[model samples]
Target chain A: MNDNPFSLWVYLSQSPLLWLTVTLVTYAATDAVSLKTRRHPLANPVLHSLWIIGLFLLLTNTSYTTYFAGAQFVHFLLGPATVALAVPLYENRTRVAAAVLPMLVALAVGSLTAIVSVVLLARAFGLPREIILSLAPKSVTAGVAMGVSESLHADPSLTAVSVILTGIMGAIIVTPLMNFAGITDFRGRGFAAGIAAHGIGTARAFQVDEVAGVFAGIAMSLNALVTSLLVPLAVTYLLR
Target chain B: MLEQIARVLLWLSLGEIAAKSGLWPLPAPVTGLILLYAELAIRGRLPDDLGILADRLLQFLGMLFVPAGVGVIAYLDVFKTEATPILAAVIGGTAITLFVTMVVVNRLGRTIAISREPGSERVEGAARDVNA
Candidate 1:
């Protein structure tokens, strides 16, 4: 009769299921709290879950590689989720079409501003060139941002980290910041979040409102396309 | 539910094909989204099952990013080294971009609303009659 707590932990750590279960359970618990709190910025499920899971790993002395081995399943779902964004865009087609020109102009300006500002700021901060280049596509989705970083000879891992941070920060601050600025239009809110934060921001937008979600999805995808094309050009001519 | 998932996967597969073939520089999911939207636009209506499935998936969209977000733990060393500058650039840059984008889009949206008000009012009135 081995009643040792550490024995159970050892057994669980060897199995891939532990991380999978941990990730889902942690997220579910935090998500419930988020909903109960009306999705307060401080109660953000992603941030909360990340902290919880990271702490768990640290406590267990589990390496990220091993944890990701099982947790990758949840990460894999991001692709299908991104595809599902089309449903809302289609559902709101009429409204989207009505604001097409404004969305386009905003997209162009927003994407350029995100890239230029990050690059300049990183340079001004005396960061390395690779870091600056990595920060250039910080507002795009992780996949696209990593690609842009690789092309620019920057660290993809750093880009991924920056991209996630940008999303989380944008999600947390965009609403309150916009409220402070007296901006209340769902489209404007969504567009700003999507263009500045990418997928994470889009996720936050969806949490706020369906209309905001749809526009955020649109802005997320559009920023991905625009940033990928523009960053390389900017890196070559502007950064050089 | 299975059928709806299959349909969604089918669109996602097409997107992957476009991405792998270099026909689209955008990610597979983004292309998938565009493909799905195009199909729905052509069909002129969303099937109920797919609609339900999409809603369910989108509802938990934030959860999907948690795994990657947790990767922050691995980079704690990087943060420890250059935390100040990185935080400053990321936070400051994002705030600026958010502010500028919101203002531009909000102004643009207002302009569009005013310019199209007359035509849109008629369209809305006709839509109301249809609903009635």
Candidate 2:
């Protein structure tokens, strides 16, 4: 056991894989805990999962890079995971065709809100051009967010955190908040989460109802398209 | 799991190609997705086995972020460098996006009632029917 790269002794000695192993295990377990706790919106699979993993990393004194090597395998899958979303959308094409107009309108509104409000407030607060660039695509998924960040000359890492935070927050608050606003329809609840939260919100929508999940998926994919175009263009032409 | 592994690798290669092409304005993964979707549309299914393959992948999608999440180390100091403004943008930006989505989507919901489709609102009623 002491010879294993991630064993307790090797871990204490700062094995590279130790931190990543612990991070993965912790999130996997925490996800279970959050799901078991009655599907609370606050459960936030990403938040709770990361919190659990971060604490473990801190306790072990293992650096983030050490863990990322092993975890990159999982990270690498995000692209394919996104591609897989096509299956469900295929299954729900009928619903998607029906709601295309409302979905498109919702996406345009959400993407604009993300860009305008962030830029206005960031400028009002006197943020640097770089931070403002990163903020431009914070509402989109990580894949698109990172792409927007790079094209606009912002820190992709910074964009990643903002995107993840938006996703987790959107996942937790969207449903009840939407119902409160009198949106009891699948298109509304799902699209809000999808356009706003991206993949994480889509996952949250899955637990609600199939209709919500379908629209959420479409909303997510379409928002990824629209936001990707809008964010980079804004930074290039408008913000500059 | 085996099929998923191969499929993912294929998708990654496809994504990389799209990203580097510079032919269109679209991002790589999205371009790959478009290609994949076109294939699916023409074929009328994403290779039957992909259904089960995708289900298993989605179940653990959260775990996949571990790599990117840990990369937060890369930015720990960016916080100190531009602490005040960065915090404002993240917190302020998130709040506005959330608020705007709620307002726009719900309003759009009333206009389109996008849930007019059968699948979205089928859960509760469907459950009761199953039980009965």
Candidate 3:
């Protein structure tokens, strides 16, 4: 029973509790920062949380594998959260039914454009096949994007990061970009944000306007479906 | 709460079985999403507990990605080597997707005159009433 500070840390870090507590605590702090700024898109809690945790690991010489041993609890929720999207979709069924035509068009065009543009740009810039494959699903929600990456045999971790980055970019730029384009339709605006950025963009839409948020929710779910299917087909064709 | 958790897990389990069996090309969670949605559509009303459960979990949805996103640290070398291309693809591709999708959809809405058409009410004011 040689109980010293270093021995305690070695013991604590080996257990899942330490990293799990760190993950949650870091998120709560970063989330407060995001809230403090009135939910500013640039102040994304996930982005802040990741870098903070990442840096902590770097300084401490902790491997991601060890950190993930505890943080997987949070990651596991992504599956149930994906399923939970049904609640919003069910609640707004009437609105979805009304604008079926435009939603359908947006889904098709937006989903294709997201996949194609990423692949082509990545390829043109001479990114390797694996990176391009991972980038293929960057526009989808993180969970679904990771699944797509796994199916394509690309790096799911890389895909997850790309998806987050894309979401942050979409959330930050959606309002200003839409305003500059002189588009006032919340439906189209929300749909574009959801399709282009996924859940983070939808969160931004919810902050700005309820109607936009609902439409963004709808678009996010629908685009998740469309992008998952399209990514496989598009990758095979484009990369072949 | 226990019942709601069980319900979600039940659907998720079935989704996993389906995915593992290669019966669906979609991810397990996605298949679960569809199954849950179809069940709700058939039932024609959201279960109170289920809705509550969803809201509770989804409120902090952003936090869930932290674990995976931190995996980026392991790939610092990848980012350093290909930062330019990767950033260009993500930022540029997103902008183009947003611009193209919004412009096209907005133009379609205007040309269709969805707002003026009676009983449609797909525009701003009517959207509130529907949600309300």
Q: Which model is ahead, 1 or 3, in terms of TM-score? A: 1
Candidate 3 lDDT over A39-132, as tens digits, reads 7667777778878898999988899899999999988998887788778778867666667787788789999999999999999999999999
Runs with alpha carbons beyond 4 Å of true place in candidate 2: A1-8, A11-20, A235-240, B1-8, B46-48, B81-88, B113-132
Q: CA lDDT of A89 in candidate 1?
A: 90
| lDDT (Cα, 0-100) at A58 in candidate 2 | 74
Ranking by DockQ: 3, 1, 2
Overall lDDT per candidate, in order of appearance: 0.85, 0.69, 0.82
- Per-residue lDDT of model 3, residues B5-119, tens digit only: 8988889889999989986766787778889989999989888999899877777777777787788657757667788889999999999999988987887766664664553
Off by over 4 Å in 1: A1-7, B114-132
Candidate 1 has an lDDT of 0.85
Candidate No. with top DockQ = 3
True contact recovery of candidate 1: 0.67
DockQ winner between candidates 1 and 3: 3
- Each prediction's number of clashing residue pairs: 0, 2, 0
| By TM-score: ranked, best first | 1, 3, 2
Q: In model 3, which residue pairs have backbone atoms overlapping below 3 Å?
A: none
Poorly placed runs, candidate 3 (over 4 Å): A1-3, A128-130, A142-157, A206-214, A232-240, B110-132
lDDT tens per residue, model 2, B37-105: 666788886666777776766666666665675566445565676766766666566656666776776
* Residue A100 in model 2: lDDT: 70
- lDDT accuracy of residue A135 in candidate 2: 73
After superposition on all CA atoms, what RMSD does each candidate show versus the true structure?
A: 4.6, 4.0, 3.8
